[model samples]
Target: MATDDGMRLAYYIVLLVVIGGAMLFELSGRGGKALRQLVLWVVIFAGAAFAAELWMNDGLGGRQTITSEGRIEIPASRDGHFHLTARLNGTDVRFIVDTGASSIALGPADARRIGIDPDDLAYVGSAMTANGQVQTAPVTIDELAIGDIVDRNVRAWVIDGELDGSLLGMSYLRTFARVSFENDLLVLER
Candidate 1:
């Protein structure tokens, strides 16, 4: 583990010990009832902690269901965004589904990870973003796949600005015959 992670774990352990000790001291006179209450509280705290950890790790919202009928269902995250994982040139890439975006736009890091050199690309194209206008470089993904669905020679752009993550925009979403929101899930049918 990294130094930061070790320190965080130690801090939580120390906090739990201190809290447990305080609870024990407060319940000393109550005997068996106090012990039961303490155990109950511990179980509740542990359950809450486990749930928080799952939410932080994207365990709850990162699940994508691909049906045999070529339909992909994505759950909306707690943050109210739909995220999907697709293979870009055979490399796994995570993207936030942005219907407002005209095309698939990759951040510098993602572009580099999928074997594209951002430094070598000429940023001749430009895009107007929420922040401002930013330079972009047009690139074609050799293969983009999500489950059994695959598209080749897909048009995309590399954004020359700070982007938290790559975007799965209308350019790619248009490939699906139907894109709809059912209940809380985003459904895309090819």
Candidate 2:
């Protein structure tokens, strides 16, 4: 996040310099054609500069910005998924926001990461997954936080089967007043 702010400041500084230079040239007896040419070059330079930043910031997407005012904006991953880093039980956990999922699903590895013992959890429940059916165990998250949004005692399931990572499902997402996708951004508002 600090890196993003620094990059933004640098971009603005460059933009200001370019604009100032163009204005100075325009004031120095530049004709309409010269003004037009300056404008075109400025546009091209700005586009290229932004393009370079985007390329450096994960193909122009991913958590490029975050707000403290009950809003979090995340850019789509290269794979086109809205993956976010959330605090689960005070630990940073990566999750893929899955609206189709009924509840937050944690893999065994993730469960352990959050201090839950998978061996002690009883896999009494089951869920129908793309890979047929998988056994699941109920678990409660002490706290889950995404940016300024936080929810306590959140219900989640620990899958006894294989999974790549934890899923942030409707159980947590529905708590938000709004969840939307615009362009390549995922906007979550309280």
Q: Give the TM-score comparing model 2 with the true structure, all chains together.
A: 0.68
In model 2, where is the ten-residue run with the lowest total lDDT? 56-65
Cα lDDT of model 2 by residue, 57-174, tens digit: 5653346356878888888876778888888998888888888889999988989999999999989999988788999999999998776778889899999888889888888888
Residue 115, model 1: lDDT of 95
Supply the TM-score for candidate 1: 0.73
**Full-model lDDT, candidate 2:** 0.83
lDDT of 1 at 150: 90
Reference-based lDDT, each prediction: 0.86, 0.83
Compose the digit string of candidate 1's lDDT tens values, residues 1-190: 5364587577568657756775675566555766767766875676577568668646643678889899999988878899898999978898999999999999999999999999999999999988899999999999999988999999999999898789999989999999999987999999
Q: Any runs in candidate 1 off by more than 4 Å, and if so which?
A: 1-49, 57-62
Error of 2 at 187 (Å): 0.9
